[model samples]
Target: MIAFENAAYSYGGGELLSEISLRLAPGSFHFLTGPSGSGKSTFLKLCYGELMPTAGRLTLFDREVRALSRDDIALTRRRIGVVHQDCQFLDHLPLAANVALPLTVAGRAAPAADLSDLLGWVGLGQLADALPPSLSGGERQRAALARAIIMGPDVILADEPTGNLDWDLSLRLLTLLVELNRMGKTILIATHDLNLIRQAKSQLAARVLRISKRRIQLAGADL
Candidate 1:
């Protein structure tokens, strides 16, 4: 669904990512690993059109990202879900409202039953009325995942999703992602957690990619 050809992104002095060439096909699961500041998040941003390549080509859903208009980019984003390390949300909004924000922003109304079912599926049914600030780290991560998928995006990009959670919570989040993958969502997660990647491999087929010295490389079998 997304392709990068010799894609390079530069900022604040030099390139953060260079010569990135990869295709994220439908129903594929990929784990992106790299050391801190190695441009894993930058690559994800390029995939979703949040950032454009400074050199080379990046395309989303068969359209060149650089050629897309602002509205086009916005429309394209509806087909992609993003989860961040911070799980950004309006602190004062209730979890239900937060999860429904995508629908609200798109000028669509969410059915109450569907909303309830989604929250319940994420194990947040009882905490729907709680404010985001009141949630624990794991709760917030699950809420973020819930909000991300509410739009029914074709692709999911998560940057450091398990960064703040413990092993158990991280595994729970991974399980949710694996379920989504089984349901045919294209998944790309950028993380430093090798153990988490190994755990995912035990349950599903996942390709691992690593970034080093501003280049992307296929991980070795020993990963």
Candidate 2:
């Protein structure tokens, strides 16, 4: 659903990502793996229109990022679900309400049944009334997953989703993502955990992409 054509992004005078051209095909699962400053997060931001390419072209669902207006970009972002590296929540609000924030931002009311089902899908049904600060690392990540998908996004872009969780919990979260992919959602997750990547590879078909020389490379052998 996201495409890049000879796209390059730069900061000051240095290019962060260059000569990038790849299309995230519909219903595909990809894991972006690279060093800390390898522009993994920058790539995710470009996919959802958070940042525009400095040169060449980048498109989301066939619409050029440079051509889309601010409002248009905001609307386009609704089609993508993002699980941030840091799963921050409003400590004052309950988990359910935090998950419902997207709906509220979209000026729509959260449907009770759907919300509950989503929470349960991410294994957070019992924590609906729990505060954010009270959740464990795994619980917060799942809650973030629940929140990310509550709006029914067509594409899921997760950045370092399992960074803080243990192996068992990481697999638990990965299972939910794999299930989502089976249901026809395009999934792209940026992570550095090779162990988690290997585990995900066992569960489903996933392409491992590495950033090298400021470009995206398919590392089939490495994974």
Candidate 3:
């Protein structure tokens, strides 16, 4: 589980997040929603240790984030899988290599058969040898999702994952996430798509959290 205890963050004398306290329970699914520049991405960064809190405690799996060294943080990140708004990848590498990157970074080789199977699961099998720069928005998002869970991570954090995709593609990605949650992986998605959230309500027990007024709240039905 990930949590923030009285947490606050500031950048260049401007407060981005303040008194932000929340918990991501294990095996749970949540959607982080808010207007632009509301610190939704910053909160996701804190969850994955990309940014440390400026005023309070940020804990992951019971350990205080500030107490961990850089190496320790990297190791901890292995337990987490993050999908960025703009799916970062090695443009020069083939789709397969990009999706299997976590394994490559860990010095573990992924078998061709397993790699192919993973790609197939995400409907990218035929494009396994294609370069990242060639895939469409949905394909890249799917590839990012495939890469994230390739390591079998315990926690998944995605920021605006479907921001650039069409409705059908967005629904497809959401279905993939819901499937992952059914497999017991905790999932948190930061998005502004209210229609997507409403659609998800019928398929999964997902909670909506809104970052507003320098704090986090369990956004009521207004979402």
Cα displacement (Å) at residue 4, model 2:
0.2
lDDT of each: 0.94, 0.92, 0.92
Q: List the candidates' TM-scores in order.
A: 0.98, 0.96, 0.98
| Model 1 misplaced stretches (Cα beyond 4 Å) | none
Give candidate 3 regions above 4 Å deviation: none
Off by over 4 Å in 2: none
Ranking of all predicted structures according to TM-score, beginning with the best and ending with the worst: 1, 3, 2
Task: Estimate the TM-score for candidate 1.
Answer: 0.98
User: Compared with the true structure, what per-residue lDDT tens digits does model 3 show for residues 56-83?
Assistant: 8999888999999998888788899999
Q: Worst 10-residue stretch by lDDT in candidate 1?
A: 214-223
Per-residue CA lDDT of candidate 1, range 1-223, in tens?
8998998999988889888899999999999998898888888888888899999998899999999999999999989999999989998889999999989999999899999999999899999999998999889999999999999999999999999999999999999999999999999999999999999999998999999899999998766
Candidate 3 worst ten-residue window by lDDT: 214-223
**TM-score of predicted structure 2:** 0.96
Candidate 2 structure lDDT: 0.92
